[model samples]
Target: MTDSRPRGRRQAEAERNDRALLQAAREVLAADGAHASVAAIAARAGVGIGSLYRRYRTKDELFQRLSALSLDHWNAAAERGLAADDPWEGLAAFITACVEFGQGSLSPIAGAIEVTEKMRAKSDRGDELLDALVARAREAGALRPGVTAVDVSLLVEQLGTSPLLDQLRRQGRDDLLDEAAGARARLVAIAVDGLRAVHAEPPPGHAPTRRLYTERWRRRPEPAG
Candidate 1:
């Protein structure tokens, strides 16, 4: 006999399950650190271990899905920033979003609570999108000129790692985090201005000026907010 349950009911159930699992995973990772096991996650989800296994075959797979979900969230936030009519404003918004996302996230899933190489690679892989955005904005004269696609992409990730930046915000240090967020926003705007394609002629066919953009390479801390 065919069941007469509404499709809406099934979809809602699935969503609830996904949310439970995601939340459970976060709790397990946080409580146990990187050594958190699948059993722990299952218990946290209040689901049978088999159910957890059904959704995520391996720990790495589970994390990869979680990581992807996290990225999608931040990326969506970035897109929201891009919705501004002015390109400079859009870029600034995206940069702020990126910084805030990093400060708030990157602790769960990995258990180690740092941006992993895998996640960093995902961000690095967005070069084409960043390049296209920069090109269009520069051509539209939103940028001040002389800035390149590579410059904006690299800096967005680098400046976002400010240890002092995310921590203050997460620790309820709203004043300092607000202070840093504003400063970072301005930084993005300056870079955008520098990158805008200028109408003025260069000395000749001047090569793109590439210099020290990031002084700090080592990993820094911040709460993903």
Candidate 2:
């Protein structure tokens, strides 16, 4: 019992440290992007640099985990949306959940981290869930004919950039933070309304493809020697 107790406590502490590190990394990266230092993240997490390095050898490793967590959040939200009875409401709910969760703020660190197979798999699954959700909405005539799943994905990404979250942290403006969130919610609502099958002119140029969006995050191949 004594041996197991110690091990369990150690595991619990390790998990807590990881959560703190991730939240700190997210905040620091959001404010400073790829240029942010590991020391900054450690300090923000109230841990020493040595402790942070013990878990993540480099900033990329840390960001890789962050990306995975973001994908997890997205996938969960997508699932919840798909389970909703109202197709349009489900889609809108998913979009709002993603944006409000600050998943979009992680985009700046995309190229900095190695896009591993696990990350790719999670992202692809997210795509699948999104495709199913969009199909449900479209078949029900809740979505505009011209809109695509990729379009909704891109729109959520665009809305996910939460600069106000950073501001709320730095400036301690909790009062204004709620106001800012409300404004964002209002914008998202308008965006959802626009996605309805009502009259609208065709968007200029062709709609963006999932391939194009995915490729943007991939590391470019090196030139021949």
Candidate 3:
């Protein structure tokens, strides 16, 4: 009977499917970049093509959504970090969340789809928070002499793409996952400590600039006609 499938049941199933699709899209897009196929995403999600099409008409659209979601996650983490009374604790906490959620791993899909104004706005907001967070740490002498917000951003991106973390997430090995987390935490602690002024030795090469960081997301200009 049509009534047997209640609206609540339908809604819950739809939500569940959406979560699966998002997870699959993240993995496939991160792995394959712009060339990732919709079929692969659907397969990874364990959903039919119909379900994928129902939500996203194209793989680009799926990647676009994921890109936007990544910004949202980062911004949320940044805001929470900004709120912490202790500057170093706030910065460390935010960095941990960003890496744990694979926030910067979505960069592989950058420029694959159009970057909308909304996404730009979100990125700008995140930049503001990043600047504030870095300033707070520097004022407290918690961050190194020349560390910039872009440096922290780049560091988070580098750590977010850990192969072991990705593999453990895929394998779902409960036993090893904790070990993986512990390893990640250790690495993060080391990275964060290196940022402190107490450990100051000028970082090799020039510090990353905001332009260099944002360039990754901007579409390259078309060749002059």
Candidate 4:
């Protein structure tokens, strides 16, 4: 006899399949960085490219999903880190987790970075969990007030894998394997301190120099003697 489930259950199973396919895409991207191919991802997911496209219209959509997955993992790690009792230790753990996650798990790209709105949306959907944690720390004097979660997010992006990480890894400098780990922790600490510092905000009406439009006169070549 064949076992049968309700029609609703069948739909749920299909949804699960779709999710699995997308997750497979994430795995492929992380392992190969930006070089992942749809065919390879489909094969890894035990599905066909057509099926994958049915779920994701193009590689761009797939990359968006990959960005979403990366942020989800990071947000979860942050939650666990913030749960620690010691504020400083919690912050340190958070930075370390960020380093660990970014090392080989994320492919840095200008395009992928543009998906930050998707990241913020996903994180916000979780009751602003990560943001709330940071806000709580700031409120408790553990972190500096006026330090938006956006600041922390941007800092992580700035300190993550340099072009050098891959270069060094390729060169067999195993010692540099976790060197950024400590530096990451210190960087986060400095950002927090700056936020907490009582330095006044720039005085009203004082604008930052706009070097974008200004050009320095080129030094004139010495007249041929």
Candidate 5:
């Protein structure tokens, strides 16, 4: 009979290498954005460059895997937000989670990768959850009328930049880190307050429908010249 113990050990080692590579990729990409080198990732994982190549033949392959993981994480956070009993609270929590994700591990890779159909589908589901959150909040009179889901989406994108936090980190100003950490939250609160019905005036023009919003917001490829 063929000895299988050696084969099993090799398989287990392969799995461990894969996990290490992925974890390293997450950290490197988060810190260095799309410009992160494969060598850097391999070094971070304490794996030989040859080993990384064995697992992921190319950088694009690695990036695609990371993108998938990010999508799964985003879906989980969205689900948690939907689970909250309070609609307004749920919306806020979801926005916060999204901002955190964008500022953390996945933001750089997310924008760098080609948008696959699978990514589009996941985005559609996310949009649906956002729609429900906004609708519920409006019904409860927590959100103002005429504030479309697109508006919230835009606000979240703006918050994801984390300008103050980034600046503080870059400056290594530990004294201000605590205050900077709350900057996004404070801005979000302000935006939400501004979105209140009592603070807003009536729109001059008709608001776009959901279909229109989706069509306009969806990223399309530029036509070949």
Candidate 6:
């Protein structure tokens, strides 16, 4: 007679494989960005290429799922900010969290995925959280009167792209690496100070939404064969 096992075992194995694939994809994509190969991800996951393809028909589909995971991360960060007792602290935490996330897992997926309505909705929710934090901080006289949520978001994005950090990582100089690692945080602190009410000045124009920035910066889709 054939050996028998519950159907649940197969389902559990499938779930484990899917989770492993996603985790591996995140790690590879974080280091290599959108150009990272599926083969690399499969190898990292210790799964066959056929296994990955069985779960996702195309690379785009896998990227889409990764994008969703990134958005969930942002949303969770926002929730933490919203939960903070001090409005200014909450806003600062939110900015720091976003910058850190971008510098790590979110960057590749951000550049890779095709924009979808579901992704847009998640981004909008994050924006809403930002708006709330800004409003609270402004009312508390912690943030400058003219500082908009967009300003904070843009600052995080700018700091997230630090060349010094990239250069240090490339050079592999242990002595300089320690200093370079703190550079982003130091810059974030400086920027946060500048957002105080004491430095208030009118913004030149309306700040662009996160959606607009994503649309402008997102990589063009690869051509079909």
* C-alpha lDDT of candidate 4 relative to the true structure: 0.60
For model 2, give the 10-residue run with minimal summed lDDT.
196-205
Which regions of candidate 2 are displaced past 4 Å? 1-5, 199-204, 220-225
In the range 71-153, model 4's lDDT, one tens digit per residue, is: 67777777876688865456556655675566234443323333446665774653365566666666666664355565555
Residue-level lDDT tens digits of model 1 in 87-169: 76666666666654552333433333344576666545444455556666766777644566545645555554555654574
Better of 1 and 2 by TM-score: 2
Candidate 4 has a TM-score of 0.50
lDDT of each: 0.59, 0.85, 0.85, 0.60, 0.74, 0.77
lDDT of 3 at 57: 86
Residue pairs of candidate 2 with colliding backbone atoms? none
Question: For candidate 3, lDDT tens digit of each residue in 1-225?
Answer: 465788999999988998999998878766776677889989998999999999888876777788788889999999999899999999989998998898767878766577888888998999999999999998998888888999999999888877786777768777898898798889988998888788768788888778888877777665699
Per-residue accuracy of model 2 over 67-117 as CA lDDT, tens digit each: 999999999999999999999899989998998888777877656668989
* lDDT, residue 125, candidate 2: 97
TM-score-based ranking, best first? 3, 2, 6, 5, 4, 1
**What TM-score does each of the candidates earn?**
0.47, 0.88, 0.90, 0.50, 0.66, 0.71
What lDDT tens digits, residue by residue, belong to model 5 across residues 1-225? 774678889899999998899888876775687789999999989999999999889887887776666667667777887799987788778777877666245555544556667767877787787788888888988877788787777666567666566567657799998887777678867866776667556444776565643454244455599
In candidate 3 the C-alpha lDDT for residue 124 amounts to 93
Residue by residue across 1-225, what tens digits does model 6's lDDT show?
753778899789889999999888866675677788999999988999999999999888987887777778877887898899998888888878877766345565565567778977997888787788889988888887677777877777676665676556556667887687687678778887888777768566776775765665366777898
| Order of the predicted models by lDDT, top scorer first | 2, 3, 6, 5, 4, 1
Worst 10 residues of 5 by lDDT: 212-221
